[model samples]
Target chain A: MPLIDEILDLAGYRREDLYVCLGCKICSSICVLNEIGIEANPRNFIINLIMEKEELRRDPLLKYCTGCYACTFFCPWEIKVPDMVRAARAALLPSHPFEQAFSSSLELFGRVYEPYLLFRLLPYFFRKGYLRLLVKGLPSFRLSLPKRVKTEGIFDREKK
Target chain B: MRYAYYPGCSLKGSAKGLDEGVKKVFSALGDELVEIPDWNCCGAFEFGEKERILALSQANIRKGREVSSEIIAPCPACLKNLREAADSSVSVLHPLEVFSEASFWDRLPMKRDLGGRPFTPYYGCILLRPREFALRVRDPMEEIITRLGGKVVSSQVKAQCCGGNLFFKELEVSERLAKKVWEGASGDIVTFCPLCHLVLKTFSEKGRRVFYLTDLILYVMGEREFL
Candidate 1:
């Protein structure tokens, strides 16, 4: 549980926040992925973390959490499951190509929707078989990536 | 009143339609929107560290203060991050809120009514959830549309998640969820956030038109956006 403590510190949560989740599955029922039967319940992550199931931290399902906060609002105990999900993510070892692309993009570009950074994630997108959707959606919208407000030093101060 | 504007990267990038519409609608409403100088992206979903998120989001707020004490953000994600990162010194406003207020109703140009086109306001998750930042106006979108002489399709899932949050990480679940939202509505869709617009516009079936709030407002004012 010492490792859990360190991760909690990383995500800025008190240990009681994890203990507050009673496995009610309220968060699961409200989850957008779980609503469509994708099994991306945030409750599962909390339980696994409590059990010290370290291997599950790197699960692809963890990536499905969009941190939408649907669960956080519905939780009776007021547990911030998204925070816990992030805590679990802090422990992830970048096993999946997504883990690499996701972090490196944020670390290097200082933002998520960087158009050029999508190339870095192509390997992950291809692996997830999302290439078709990505390709189809690209042309419908504008890409103001070239004119994006310069965000140079923001990433330098905090190396998360 | 003049207000500082923070068009987060999405509105400037993938969601330029809303960005353009924001300028047009605000001008038509007789207000000026000043872009926050050197405003960076409000990092909520990106920065995992609490301090990092606050630092980044607050930095945008600080820049916003240089222009005005009250700031308006078109993207819900950006609004949420800025609101969460903000303290008592300044206030963050969703453009929808500014447009929905009863006092501002007289200011609507109303060049032409919505022509009775049915519009469903997709408030989406980020805009409504976590409660504090939720729009106080009951049925802001419906009321505005109805007031402007448009029909509104009533649906329970107005605050539903469009899967934009998980869009980059994956698509199947996000796509299905977004489709359910679009198909659930009876007519055209009006969205406040660019991610919501992107998701609803991308996966939605052919012939279904998704409108950003600003875009719809502009159209009603006799300026059809150059779609």
Candidate 2:
């Protein structure tokens, strides 16, 4: 599928929105591409996608996106480039193993830890006085996560 | 007013000052901040690379579900992570947003000065585009800055990421970005996020003043009357 079409299907962005884009290259000019030594250009990517090209979606440059929304922020028309890319990513979700693992971990973390464990450990991490202050500032009751859920592999490598 | 507070990892460690400052202010505001129990790390900078949306959004939704009230995150990264998580069911707001609302604004004790200069308000990345939150702090921050003999200047660059986490992976890139942040500002940069504080502090070459919002608040509150 064409990247733009796939993204439009997911995000509901219209073709008229693309017509307003002037290709001024402002998005690329301010982009931190050189910092990472990648030639990723939002303008070119959008233009290619609009042209019904498939190669643009397969570009290795797409992987370099930090999803920081820098391009979207600088765009004069307020085009959501990050959202568009996010949609494209959703289409390609099955291919990325790491992302799948990470997402699974979020669900697992909530299921495994209970309120009692968090309450005891949380205070130790904060300053004694600050913890007391936190307790005082908070409401009188405790909130807990769900009791059980399937756990997954989010961490394959340990942090050094 | 009540909020579900997510005080990311740094608040317990290097950013303890933020925890102290927020507590004092929130107490004064007569607001209740309920910490989301059993909250895991927001996955910070690493999650973006691992799973752009799901990893970021799940932590937020999980916290949002645990707390009935809106989630008030003090850390800019945490706020950004949650907001970007793509979860629509729960509302995620910055602590400043809660503090700045008219109902709670009046409750906060506004002090005039710090070392005879005005207090400057820095809205780092996450809070910059959110007009409501930024506007809320403007008046009070300006009042405090003026009393301290300091001037408040808003910068387009204030919203830029501090590039701290990117440092380990890309040192030169982070440094260059940090330099741009420094060049874009006049006087000290005051921010609410701990990650921004750590990044700015690391990149600061000498004589460049960077302060966490809590530090300035504490100075003003400590110098004046207690809540």
- Best-matching candidate per lDDT: 1
Q: Write the per-residue lDDT of candidate 1 for residues A94-158, one digit (tens) a residue.
A: 44555456555555555555565567776776777766765655424455444334554667754
TM-score of each: 0.87, 0.64
Q: Write the per-residue lDDT of candidate 1 for residues B1-227, one digit (tens) a residue.
A: 89999987677666677788888888877899999876776764654567767777888888889899999987877887888888898999988788877666788777777778777877887787777766555678877778878788855768887888767656777888898897688777877777777777779787777777777677777788442
DockQ per candidate: 0.47, 0.09
Across A112-136, the per-residue lDDT of candidate 2 in tens digits comes to: 1324433444544253333443342
Worst 10 residues of 1 chain B by lDDT: B40-49
Which stretches of model 2 miss by more than 4 angstroms? A1-22, A29-40, A48-68, A82-160, B43-66, B84-90, B103-105, B110-112, B115-121, B129-149, B154-156, B223-227
What tens digits encode model 2's per-residue C-alpha lDDT throughout B1-227? Answer: 67777776567545767876787778777877787765655655443233533454475567567775477778766676677663557777766656556675456566654544432365555455333222235544454455445667754565565555444334455667667677777667787766567666667666667776666666655632531
Worst 10 residues of 1 chain A by lDDT: A139-148
After superposing candidate 1, which stretches have Cα over 4 Å from the reference? A54-61, A93-114, A118-153, A157-160, B225-227
